[model samples]
Target: MERARFDNLPLEWIRAFEAAARTGSFTAAAQETGVTQSAISQRIDKLEKQLGTHLFLRQARSIALTVEGETWLPHVQTAFESLRQSSEGLFGAARSRLTISASSSIIDLWILPRLARLTEDIGAQLSLRTMVLAAGAAQEDDTIRIRYGAGDWPVAYKVPLYNEMIAPVAAPELLASASDWKELPRIALSGPRPGWNEWSARHGTPTTPLPALRFDTFVSALAAARAGHGVLLASLPLCAGDLAGGKLLRVCEESLSCHQSYWLLASNEAVSRRQWNRLETILKDPVPREGA
Candidate 1:
């Protein structure tokens, strides 16, 4: 006997054939699969040609499975169902291993100090990665991403984390010694967003540009601030610890909202996990009071 020819049988046609057989109507199957009834019929007809067997007995009002279809239906349905279940299982497991990617400033100033408290074992190892916001959007594989922006995204789940509120901060000695705001040297905290001009506008200070010492990272900027190097326009949360510790002081009470916010994003695959739930729980916790 000649071995059965599988070459003529297409996976798409098999899928269509399976759906039509399972639903007992071409019209119903087409609706489920988002295709036209005639398309489903054509697929089934092609499948039948490939197999040299009639799979359905068509009637004006309804359809009934022929002997061959009755035989093939269970196997096809079982295979597809098993594939779907396995895929879900694998995806769920992958999602549990959380890798959070964000701007370096956020990781250094906000997330690093607080991670020890999320001690629960959720069968996932938490990891952090940094990417440049100015470069482009997060890749499709990134699990949890915190970005600074207005949060307009297409085809994604996005949540506003915090507004980029900023104010001038410096070591206690630097503020005590500077004659006025105009006398201080400007300092650059490494990140894409800028706050100096915005601060000047909000505080009614003159827009005379000051020469800034550039630091490659927020942590470096914080270090310089702590050492009384210059005036640093820093994110509130990023400098929260230093301010609380008395290492750094806010230069002025007034702060300018940068209009950009930190947003939490997840790919569809990463959103469904219990680990993501736990991460969100950690993120949503209120920042401790300045002195607390």
Candidate 2:
């Protein structure tokens, strides 16, 4: 029997395989491809037969990609992206309108500062949609979304916003007034970033002071900290530009390297392979803060 040529693998079969591998479920792949689960499974089976290797480890409730599947996934995604780039180059327009759904704090702190550069670099009309739910933008169906996590968003291209580095921050006046930065009134945030208790535990400080003020939103807490209300356990990456410009002062030398981070869930349509390199630079690399 002759080995099957790579190009002979049907695009639909490849799509089924890619979707199943990425989502880690035949049902999800079916939903994404607008087909039934049986069809997804059948296509994958055909592809596996063609390749003479199993792509997924079948389990009771979940599926794990075989090493071959894991290795081939990126290549498939890249090929699709290349095809998109060529099509876009020949037939697509000069600029596009893209809406980003995320929490208001991320819009205000991280993405907004680079708005001008981001739009210009990517050639898109950028629109910001502030997510109202406590879940943030994770549940949104917008063209782009940002989520906070350990960055395992396999279904979409994960554009890393930042690794969370948190430290206590305060306005200069508050720091000057208080002799011990640790004893200053603590401002608390309600979400994922670690608060005073975690900070204290990590630093081995026995007494964890109660927060003088608490807010459900990071932006509000940050505003309070900036207004000299209290010292905030700040996400350093989110406010790196501000720290660089002396708008906020890091109270201590120590910072906790929380394993989680904010990720921009980008698809090829959200940011094309052609534009992604430059777009990533605009997002990940530091830019000049506007309206300083």
What TM-score fits each model? 0.63, 0.69
* Candidate 1, 126-230: lDDT as tens digits: 788886645555376556788777887652456766666788887878778866855777787555667566667678786665646887777777788788878
Tell me the lDDT of model 2 at 22. Answer: 82
lDDT of 2: 0.80
Model 2 Cα shift for residue 1 (angstroms): 14
Which candidate ranks first by lDDT, i.e. highest? 2
- Candidate 2 backbone overlaps, count: 0
Off by over 4 Å in 1: 1-36, 39-94, 119-122, 132-138, 190-192, 271-273, 288-292
Q: How close is candidate 1 to the true structure, as a TM-score?
A: 0.63
Model 1 worst lDDT run, 10 consecutive residues: 283-292
For residue 180, model 1's alpha carbon misses the true position, in angstroms, by 2.8
